[model samples]
Target: MVGTSEDLHRLFSFYWFLEAESRNTRSREWAEYFTLIRTQIDLFTMDKFDEELVTQSREAARSKPLKFWSRYRISGGALA
Candidate 1:
């Protein structure tokens, strides 16, 4: 599945809450069960694209004249 890392983290957080609530019960045996499910799930994020494109854009901006750098804005890890 594809989603932002924040969403994925939130999903795991919910699982943790469920585990915590069931602590001391037979259900506790399923603690972190999502971890096992995650092992079989393929997840993808735009982190690599942002790291490569945005980082390079920022570096290139640093080398440009101040006027050029100021002409464009970097928003959401993208050149805008």
Candidate 2:
């Protein structure tokens, strides 16, 4: 479902509403992709993200024709 940056952002935008539904987003690949996007989107929307930060991230988010940053891998830490 999420193949490009625009796709990712849309998924991220729909994020909170999706979470409220308790529905799986069909594919694990897309789901993981959206998770990262969600974090970025959340940061962008949040006051702490800042204008400068948002500007940089927005540019990055637009520039990268991300073919799914989801290799089923996160910057490892604890599993939830």
Candidate 3:
């Protein structure tokens, strides 16, 4: 379990670096991908931890509402 956690952590680190470095171009995709991977890491890391940690995690998530641009939306003009 420790090794698996470490590997996931490394993947999260790599994706985070990619997101930070490519903030100007294709950042949303990278950011969303990072978020997905981060979720896995957070779940694994906190699975055996205390309830306070879980509560803190939920609080942190609640504090950050997705931005306008970050909201997933399809782009297309209406037919005339």
Candidate 4:
């Protein structure tokens, strides 16, 4: 289980990467892998980590506009 904010941040980043990859590839295998990872993350947060910290880390990862833009380029700067 993750024990610190840094670890949570790393996990969230990985989660984001997996999710993005699953979307970009449109593969069932990647989608399943992302779902498994998400389940593990949820279990860890519920069983061993602080809820607030997990929430904050998830929010931080989701709110990174630069990361989003770099990973996915949309026409006319629209969101993906």
Candidate 5:
């Protein structure tokens, strides 16, 4: 399992669509999503993606409740 509320599995919670995409086990979709994250992450550069990275991103997001923009990293970090 990913984790509980305390842990909150930020990767899954924040990247809920990714979790769904993974659960569906669609490699093409995951690849597209992975590519999106790699090419478009604004704050930091990432060569690879994993649960830890996802969680860290989510945590960073939580620190600022007032931020208006959506940080959802979709295909090539495109706006959805």
Candidate 6:
């Protein structure tokens, strides 16, 4: 979930932890995938993303090369 820049950053931070904890190539791959998505999030936010950007962001992530986290999606909330 992501309501603001901080929220998105938190999600990315979790992904960072996942990347660090990964033990296999697949897990690591997913980590890099999420990292890219996170980078997009950061850029999208910096660009002042509104509803339109939100849609674009999701779509962009959907098109990523790796789809390990296809089931996961960013929404209007925070990780915790």
TM-score per candidate, chains pooled: 0.30, 0.32, 0.34, 0.68, 0.24, 0.32
Compare the candidates by TM-score and give the number of the best one: 4
lDDT of 6 by residue, 1-80 (tens): 33763444444444444443343335556667766766775575656656664555444443441333433333312332
In order, candidate lDDTs are: 0.38, 0.46, 0.45, 0.67, 0.44, 0.48
| Residue pairs in collision within model 1 | none
Task: Name the top lDDT candidate.
Answer: 4
Which window of 10 residues has the lowest lDDT sum in candidate 6? 71-80
Cα lDDT over the full model 5: 0.44
lDDT of 4 by residue, 1-80 (tens): 52877667766766676666667655687678878888898787767877788899877766652454346522233435
Per-residue CA lDDT of model 3 for 1-80, tens digit only, reads 33343343344444344344344445577667656765675675567545465455444433432332233232322211
Assess candidate 4 and give its lDDT.
Answer: 0.67
Tell me the tens digit of each residue's lDDT in model 1 across 1-80: 34444444444344333333344334434544634443332222224334444334433433442342233332222333
Using alpha carbons, what is the TM-score of model 3?
Answer: 0.34
Candidate 3, residue 76: the lDDT equals: 22
The TM-score of predicted model 4 comes to 0.68
> Per-residue CA lDDT of candidate 2, range 9-77, in tens?
444435543342234455666666666666766665555534554455445544442334322223332
- Report the lDDT tens digits of candidate 5 across residue range 1-80: 33333333343344444433444544776757755653454223233345565556556545532222334434445543
- Which residue ranges in model 4 land beyond 4 Å of their true spot? 65-80
Question: What C-alpha lDDT, on a 0 to 100 scale, does residue 7 get in candidate 3?
Answer: 40
After superposition, which runs of candidate 5 have C-alpha atoms over 4 Å from their true positions?
Answer: 1-4, 19-70, 78-80
Determine which window of 10 residues in candidate 3 has minimal summed lDDT.
71-80
lDDT of 1: 0.38
Q: Order the candidates by lDDT, highest first — what do you get?
A: 4, 6, 2, 3, 5, 1
